[model samples]
Target: MTNAADRIAVSTWSLHRMMGTTYPHNLDTLEVGPVTEAYGPVNESLLDIPSAIANHGINRLEIVSFHIPTRDKVYLGELKSALAAVDVTLQTLLIDAGDISDPLTSDRDTRWIASWIETANELGAERARVIAGKQKPTRDALDLSVKKLTELADGNAGSAVRLTTENWFDLLAEPGHVNFILDKLDGRVGLNGDFGNWGGPTKYADLRAIFGRAETCHAKASFVDGTLDEADYAACIEAAEAAGYKGPYTLIFDANAPHEWDGIAAEKAFIEARIG
Candidate 1:
């Protein structure tokens, strides 16, 4: 049986509080400079994150595109080398930008997203998680997302990295839209199901409805008063497991809990107790 440590993955976003820097190149504004905040001075390089997380007994790392300092080949090569040094895996390159569902920007954004997918391949990541769409859920939006995403899948056919869309933004807000787009893609694009993206009483059912198709998961748990909401987190993992999901659970620690790794440990333990 896989242990909690083996099944665990960490998103760089989880450690944003400590990462201390942001590469604005991938942000919506397209600014190309580094931004260091007061909370986290520019103390660490992105290259150092692998060995840092590896020290936590977690080797699977998912990087948000925005966190990358540059697309320079030398830098990317160094990053890949760093991962190999620590025996860590680049679980996914999260292309956290673009909206292919909008008519005005569809073509441009499709090209932009494709470039990030190429970056994913260069860094030797196993997957590239792209945003499907953020436009209101309309039939036209879904159709555009399907066409553009299928094209992306085809474009990545010969590359080392795979493609996955998330249950995030507006396009995949519900199970019906999620299934419709996935059905239309016909297995060309994969799913990166997120636990906290969908809410309401139907959250668990919605997770069960689509997690069966998930290739990976964002095991995000809710927190109240800086405390881990154990019941909510347990139910989310239970729902995913019930739907036959047996993939790496990427721990997403967004809220400023007592400690980032502490929050991650709590999540890892819950998943281990549930299905690890």
Candidate 2:
């Protein structure tokens, strides 16, 4: 049995897609932040999210970078203040940059990423979720990523933030690749495990292998022929716990449905029940 300290967390992205809406009423209504697009070009509705989530009994929030203007700190500060007013905690911030695996490193990309790290620090975020970049033409790309990530980590060393690189291709498709990256990085980085993204039947097994190294997780569920399967989800949760992982688990619902929030709540209940 898992201890109470090992409770799973539900990401608002799952609820956002489930509800078919972004930025639900307020944190007071949904305890989760709907994955929203950046408002105009600079602002994010951070204050509004916590209230909606608070209403729904959710105080923890994982803000996706796609929703916030990564270049502007002043606007970010405003958003941060709004969250602080409602006692909302920023759990994880995801940044989706173009081709993380691209071999040709750009000074512009590096600068943009540096800005992101700074913004994450200002918001007091615990971790930043980054794509594995673009897939490279040669194996040397892995070494390049390690060097770049190490640099990012070094810059943020004084802050609370840690860089978590997520698996895009089959890089993390198996335990070997997962361990390979961890071993090469030497604990300087960690994995952001996304349950539904794995391409094949090995999803459950892969989760089991990497759970111990997960700093944060993305909980994604699917509807097979219009029905939600609890058994598949139960297996994912079981794997997470069995590996002795105790951290925040965010639910990311990617399906498109009008009343998807109901499904998300159900999944959360199902996982929480098993955790008990």
Best by TM-score: 1
Candidate number achieving the greatest lDDT relative to the actual structure: 1
Predict model 2's lDDT versus the native: 0.64
> lDDT (CA) for every model shown?
0.88, 0.64
Q: By TM-score, how accurate is candidate 1?
A: 0.95
Error of 2 at 90 (Å): 0.5
Count of residue pairs whose backbone atoms collide, per candidate:
0, 31
RMSD (Å) of each candidate, 1 decimal: 1.9, 6.7
Error of 2 at 148 (Å): 1.1
lDDT of 2 by residue, 1-276 (tens): 144324444554544432333432221221234555422232214446667666655556787654553335677788788778877778777765634445554444555666666767888877887665565324565666666777777877867788887756643455776677778888887788777877467778878888888877776667665456777877887888788777766766665442455665666666667765
| Model 2 bad stretches (over 4 Å) | 1-12, 15-46, 69-71, 136-138
TM-scores for all candidates: the values are 0.95, 0.81
- Tell me how far the alpha carbon of residue 38 in candidate 1 is from the true structure, in angstroms, after superposition: 7.6
